[model samples]
Target: MDAKTLERLLNQIAAEHLHIDTLATRNSDRLDFHEVSVWGLKEALQAAFTAGQQSKQTTQPN
Candidate 1:
């Protein structure tokens, strides 16, 4: 993806992360069953962003 598109995706992910964090905080005590799922989703999003950045770096000319 181009820089603009990648940036947009990252922004969207960040927004979603914030939303999820808020939800998790609000339901922290009751979300034990879903804690793992939520954590995994956050990690996956972060990994995706990191991979995108790494790929962009590798493909760009220094």
Candidate 2:
């Protein structure tokens, strides 16, 4: 996909991650499960963001 499309997807993922994190924080009873999920999501987000950044850098003109 093009850089713009990739960037937009990443933004959506980030927004969803934030929403999930907020829900996790609000539900204290299932905190452990939610926290684990949030951690996994965070890792995935970081990896995606890193890949997107690398793609953008390589595609840009010097």
Candidate of highest TM-score: 2
What lDDT does the true structure give each of the candidates?
A: 0.60, 0.62
Candidate 1 lDDT over 1-62, as tens digits, reads 78876666655654455333322245445542333466657765786778788888998999
| Candidate 1 deviation (Cα RMSD) | 7.4
Off by over 4 Å in 1: 1-36
Which residue runs does candidate 2 get wrong by more than 4 Å?
A: 1-36
Native-referenced Cα lDDT, model 2? 0.62
Judged by whole-model lDDT over C-alpha atoms, candidate 1 comes out at 0.60
Using alpha carbons, what is the TM-score of model 1? 0.42
Clashing residue pairs found in predicted model 2: none
